[model samples]
Target: MSGNRLYLSVSLLLSVGYFWLGWSLMQPEPKHNFTPCLFKNVTGIACPSCGTTRSVLLITKGHLQEAALTNPLGLLAAIIMLTLPAWLLYDFFRREKTFYNNYSIAERFINKNKKIIIPITVSLMLGNWIWNICKGL
Candidate 1:
């Protein structure tokens, strides 16, 4: 197979595996211990991505609110997890950056407002981190 095809196949497999692993981890008697978040382990503070795994697990189990409370970014991950396969399939057929082309206007807006965007992103991350810490995740 060509390199691009091989890469897409590998990516699709890994994405599916990730979702399956999340589902398996949510089982009633998971046989493995959950790994603590590395950033939290060293810093003793919740990172922006803290609780993301639990959030994904909760989302897989149909607990949307709990998933959001666990970590909003987890919701984003779930969306990506669900959509990536389709996107990859489309990309494999098209072999073009259609997503970027279609969203060029939005991309230009982001580039223009990069300074403003940075602060907003930082505040949102900080807020999420604070919420995670409050929940003692």
Candidate 2:
């Protein structure tokens, strides 16, 4: 009922979800086409996330270059998104007090750099999108 307990519970839930998500990656992906990007249908430009899933699939299939051509940001997205939940789980299980301790250096690094890092990441993804479009992906 306290804040720390609540956080611990949420972390456990996220850990379970991440475990399932990671497990699902080993299974077959479903076919779906519901792109919200107008670039795909209008100007014929590939959007930043246009082939993200396909790129991830190709990466899983060992087509590294093809994946990069499809979405250069795919690996970055995959690592951050997937690793976040994994880290949450790790902290929950390991009782990593550093995650809670404000003095933790890793926490300090994230807090200090996230603002600048996000915009740079966004720009990179957008650049990759334009590149993919130019490549006729």
Residue-level lDDT of model 1, residues 60-111, one tens digit each, is 7899998998899989888877776666667668886554454566778889
lDDT of 2 by residue, 3-115 (tens): 37756765676567456446657766657654546778787667777776666667777888988777867666556556666666676788775445633565578779999
Model 1: weakest 10-residue lDDT segment is: 96-105
Q: List all candidate RMSDs to the true structure.
A: 4.6, 5.5
lDDT of 1: 0.77
Clashes of each: 0, 0
Model 2 worst lDDT run, 10 consecutive residues: 97-106
In the predicted model 1, the residue pairs found to clash are none
| Native-to-model Cα distance after best TM-score fit, residue 118 in candidate 1, in Å | 0.8
Candidate 1 residue runs with Cα over 4 Å from true position: 1-34, 100-107
lDDT of each: 0.77, 0.67
The lDDT leader among the candidates is: 1
